[model samples]
Target: MATLHHSSFCPHSRFVRLIMAEMGMEPHLVEERPWERREEFLMMNPAGTTPVLVEEGGLAVPGASIIAEYLDETRGLGLSGLRLLPESPAARVEVRRLLDWFLQKFDQEVTGYLVTEKIHKRFMTSQHGGGPPDMNAIRAARSNVRYHLKYIGYLISRRNWLAGSQLTYADLAAAAHLSCVDYLGDVPWDEDEMARNWYARVKSRPSFRSLLTDRVAGMAPADHYADLDF
Candidate 1:
């Protein structure tokens, strides 16, 4: 079996986890603190990011995007209708576009700030820059989240999922990031009914079960974090 090095609140890590679950994979999960910058971990991924997948034969796949593509290439063909990536090149492009939107753009604008300030810092020591949460960054992320929720609402209003009618990696990527913010109670779900409904549908999936139960060590999630009907 493969082993995945991940962090509980990292959206990119969460994205890969959801992908693996949807693909019916059961890799061993190892929680990694990237800030700690362990020598062995760095050797696996010199960039020191989470969500590194180590195969049984000692192959290390680093980064969520790379890992997602690697898994799809390795296992997705067998899944047929259940494949998270589409068959058509154009369709695949759309999925990758949304993947970039959520994993990179959304992260830069939202989760990167919220998670770092609210979750990551709490786990780090002063030597690694841990301290009281940065309210300014948190406030900016909070404000930015509303816009993202509105965008999600806009996208879902016209289609069954973020990229299209199919449930692709796009949906998983978006849901993963939103789930992290939702855990922090930073998402303004009530402000976008369409987005909230879409999230509810995604949240209810069996693949989402583990994420719904994830907890931060010293901090509990938002009241509705694990509520399926919320």
Candidate 2:
């Protein structure tokens, strides 16, 4: 069995968790608070990121993308239409490009702000005693979210998923970030019916059930978050 070092609410960590569930592999879950800067955690991945995977031979894999590939390669979890990468050069490039979009774009526009405000406190404590989140930054993030939804809406209206016709890593990665936003009702579900319809299918997956159960301190998930049909 593989061991994964991660926290419960991190979007990146959640990415790895979703991949594990989708691939049907059970990994030992070890929580790591990124701010703690522990030597042991540092040793696993000097980059200091969560979602580190330690293999049987003790090769530590960092980043959700790498870990997902490792699992598919080692565990033979490759489902015909579900393998994230494509064999064709063009399609494979597109898949990787979309993956980067979600990891970087969505991270900057959505997860970065929300995590720092609502989710980070529970996992990342301030180096100083305790500090309140920056309301101004939160406001900017909230505003940025609207554009992202419009973009996703356009994608859903045109393509079957966030990528092209396939449900690649792009979908899972986007879903990972959106799950956090959705938990807080930050997603404007009524913004676009196509996007809402797309989300309805994504959120109904067995891989999504655990995320629906996630809770944040002092904030209840949006009432409709766990409702599969809603």
Candidate 2: worst-modelled 10 consecutive residues by lDDT = 121-130
lDDT of 2 by residue, 6-63 (tens): 8777888888888878888678989887777779989888888888988768999998
Per-candidate TM-score against the hidden true structure? 0.98, 0.92
Question: Please, what are the lDDT tens digits per residue for candidate 1 over residues 20-42?
Answer: 99998899999999999999999
- Identify the leading candidate in terms of lDDT: 1
Q: Model 1, residue 41: what's the lDDT?
A: 99
Best by TM-score: 1
lDDT of each: 0.93, 0.80
Q: TM-score of model 2 relative to the true fold?
A: 0.92
Give me candidate 1's TM-score against the actual structure. 0.98
